[model samples]
Target: MADEGRRDRCLAAHEAPPVPPEGPVTTRLPRRSFARSATEVAPELLGHILARRLPDGVVLRARIVETEAYDQNDPASHAYRGRTPRVRVMFGPPGHLYVYFTYGMHHCMNVVTGPVGTASAVLLRAAQPLEGMERMSIRRRTDRVRDLCRGPARLAQAFDVDRSLDGADLVRGSEIWIERGPGASAASIRRGPRVGIRVGTDLPWRFWIDGPWVSVSRPAAVLSPR
Candidate 1:
């Protein structure tokens, strides 16, 4: 496995525009689409498009660039505590949002996966703004497009995702939804230890594109030993 240094290194430059989706613009990914376990879904999330439609019909979209997986057996996962009120969504029918307020301030989001009673999810880490840059910047209070959604909390802020969106169906496009975008092969993806966790920190569950400027700036050094 690549060490932390290599895992956290910046990827090669990718300056090209997003490749057109393979089929008709995806409106919503199906419920069964995310029935796989979190580890299996995390890497596959890269290059997908996440969108949220506003009251005025404004649709904001960002291309997912990074993600991390968590499951019930993982000590760091919320579900490890076993079916608490806030974590109940993680045991789901899949393709639903599992949002939580963290640090008593910022909100982070995850896509529920696995079986109905299996708690597993993929935390969206960063994304490349694909549409509605102006609103995203306004919401994020930053003019730097690159920083709009460069972290889990930041992604939630930029997309206006919060507790209100918890358990929202992603397979339905009425509000928030994930659409199929381009797919990246294993050669184009990299894995790393999960971030900002004191437990299960050694699990190499984090995945990201191997060559995309849109990814968050990797830490100068690994924060924890893996």
Candidate 2:
């Protein structure tokens, strides 16, 4: 795809504003109204690129890895628990932000996956470490390629994504955006259960490029359920 080369080659190869010396005014579509819907959001994100601006001012990018769909009917989702200040954004339109704090102090990000009111979203489980490799190494404090951006929480930190990015838009924003990345050869695309959710694990919602070191975990090729 048009973005794969941009990502695979170099972060600067893509035409995005460099992080300003004093931080430019954040301008873009307000992703405050998009609801989270997993079913619709997962498959749609397959070829999209997920990018974040790092601390050093370089943009760190990754291709979407495994994703899980969450919706109202999906008992495992947080929305089903009802609206609170934290999830209020999930109740907004179809292009809003849904940010939350979990695992003690780490922050994780999710794209409101489906249309408004659907409350479905795709959980960005893992990403193939792309641009900003050195900076990523610094933030993650590791030189091991597989350890960086291998999990939802780690990727968020590596990309410098936090509550600050909540409600940021992807269609036209510098903070986070997806570009068309490499096509997983039909045979290379692997699918399975979404990670870490005891309830949703039964559903075949996870997806990843077979054997790409960037997959958050080295899950064996799953042909069917566990």
> Relative to the true structure, how large is the alpha-carbon lDDT of every model?
0.78, 0.62
lDDT per residue for candidate 2 within 93-169, as digits (tens), equals 66544666787788877777556666666667677777788888887899987878777788777777666566655
Clashes of each: 0, 19
Residue range 1-226, candidate 1, lDDT tens digits? 2244432321110122222232333555677779999988888888889888764668899888889999999999999989999998899789989999988889999999999999999999989898999999998999998789888888899888767667777774356778888866676677878888999988888888754434544432222312
Best prediction by TM-score: 1
Error of 2 at 224 (Å): 12
lDDT of 1 at 94: 95
- Steric clash pairs (candidate 1): none
